[model samples]
Target: MARYAILVRGINVGTAKRVAMADLRAVLEESGFSAVRTHLNSGNAVGTGNDGLDPAEAGARVEEALAARTGVSARTLVLTAGQLRTIAAGLPYAAEMAAVEKAGSRMMAHVLFADPDPALLAEHDLTAIDPGNVQLGERVVYQWCPNGLLESPDVSGWITKNLHVEVTTRNWNTIAKLADLL
Candidate 1:
């Protein structure tokens, strides 16, 4: 069995895309995922499944199920437990304890598809990110958008609008919990 963290985008935002976490958990359980757990109301789920099922397919199934039940289409990003662990271990902010402390805030790491082109990273102006910070990694981008998540520029929105890759974000707390889950 493989453990996976599934992120469902555009749910529970404003009046649109509303999905109950309980219903999501039920859908995953019905879909044959074991040890299923949800984090917050933002559509983050940790579950384990048999080796026969593909992770991407599982994600799509879950998205479809959620949309069919809730009348909203969700973009799902699926990552193995190991992949999430690697992302947590490679966090640049972990080494800069002082800067992290002084920032008096938390950070979020956005997992993006691996791309070699520099243009993909430069698509968004760094200055517009505000007190929010951004760092491009080999397969992810670290964002420190501290003025609360909704207030900050939607990094996922910008990336999707400008880049041709899939991206999903998790806050520091979510990352830490995911590490614990792994």
Candidate 2:
């Protein structure tokens, strides 16, 4: 069996895409995943699935099941337990970023396309901006918004405009918790 971490984008932010965590767990279990568990209110789940299924395949199954059960389309990012751990461990500027967050800055991690083109990172030249710092990793991008998500400079906007890559951002805190769940 392989453990996978699933991230659903824009599912529980407001009342619009509400999906109860319990329901999500039930959905995954019913879809043949075992030891399903969810963390926090956001659609993050970690579970063991049948052997030979990769993260992409597992994610597709979960997304289909979720749409069928909840009647809402959701974009999901699924990573293996090893991938999740690597992402958490590879976070840069831990103390400095934490201090910024403690001082009211927001730390967000953008999960890039499942197979983000390496050239895209170079094409856009994601860099540190005023009142915020952006760093691109293997399959994740870290941005510390000193102001806030709404107030900070449009990191996602520029990425979408220039690179045209689909991404979903989650707070570093949520990511850390997800890592722990795995």
Candidate 3:
């Protein structure tokens, strides 16, 4: 069996999507995922499943269950434990550690659902994303928002808008916690 981290977007933010972590865990467990658990109330979940469980399929199943059982529809992304560890490990070793240390919650990662188009990625550059602030990795993009999330380049939003891709973001602290949960 392999462990997977499920990220549900746009939930528990403001008064709109308010999905309880316990409810999400219950739904995931009922959907056939084993060892299901939730980290924060912010839509992060971890669970164990068969080796053949597809991430996209798991995401869809979680979405369907959330909609049918909880009445909240949101985008979900799944990553293998190894993938999550890789993303966590990819940090701290890079030359951008200074920004990371200083940014705190500003150090954000845009976890993507799939490999975006190369041409689309190269066609435009986000001006607000500093050189050291942007580090693209396998199915993920890490950026430091020194002035906070509001002042950042909105890399995830830009990708979804231009590349037509779906993405969810997490702060460095949240990423570390999710990695630990896996």
Candidate 4:
């Protein structure tokens, strides 16, 4: 079996694509996944499944199972344990971005499906961010926009709303915690 982290987008937000974690787990288990566990309620799951399936195939299977159970289509992203570890290690903002020790402040890394097109990164007006704090990696982009994630224009709704790519974000703290889970 191979371990994977599966993230489903657009779930439990303003009542669209609502999938209870229990139901999601049931579907995954029914589809032959083992050691299933969910994080929070935003459709993040860490589990073990058949080794032969790739992330894309695992995502498709999860989506199909979820739609069958909840009657809502979901966009999913799956990362293997090794891939997740690589992403955690490759975070660009780890050294440059200051840590926020406050209760709700978040330090996050957004995992992109592919290395962003260099042309797109070049075109984005990144002048608003501290040049030293931003690190662009092969499949991850790290930004230490501290004052709460919503406050940073560089890491806010704009990137997710405008960029035509699939991204799944996890706070630095969450990344560390999940590493232990693996």
TM-score of each: 0.78, 0.88, 0.90, 0.81
Candidate that would win on lDDT:
3
Of 2 and 3, the candidate ahead on lDDT is 3
List runs of model 2 lying over 4 Å from the truth.
98-105, 128-132
| Candidate 4: segments with Cα more than 4 A from true spot | 95-99, 102-105, 118-132, 154-163
Off by over 4 Å in 1: 95-105, 113-132, 146-154
Per-prediction count of colliding residue pairs? Answer: 0, 0, 0, 0
How many steric overlaps does candidate 3 have?
0
Comparing 2 and 4 by lDDT, which wins? 2
Q: Return whichever of 1 and 4 wins on lDDT.
A: 1
Model 2: residue 77 alpha-carbon error in angstroms: 1.2
Query: Number of the top candidate by TM-score?
Result: 3
TM-score of model 4 vs. true structure? 0.81
List of clashing residue pairs for candidate 4: none
- Tens digit per residue, CA lDDT, model 3, 1-182: 88999899989989999988889988888766899888778898889998988889888998999999999999888889988998888773245545355554877888888888989878866434566677778788888777788886778877788777888999888888889888
Per residue, candidate 2 scores C-alpha lDDT tens digits across 101-153 of 36323777778756556687666567845333787776777777766778777
What is the alpha-carbon RMSD of candidate 2 to the true structure? 2.3
lDDT of 4 by residue, 1-182 (tens): 88887778778878787889999899788766789888878777788888877788778887898888989798787888887888777766544444445422356667776555567667775434545445665566666765667766555343554444577777776666566677
lDDT of each: 0.72, 0.77, 0.82, 0.71
User: Which is better, 1 or 4, measured by TM-score?
Assistant: 4
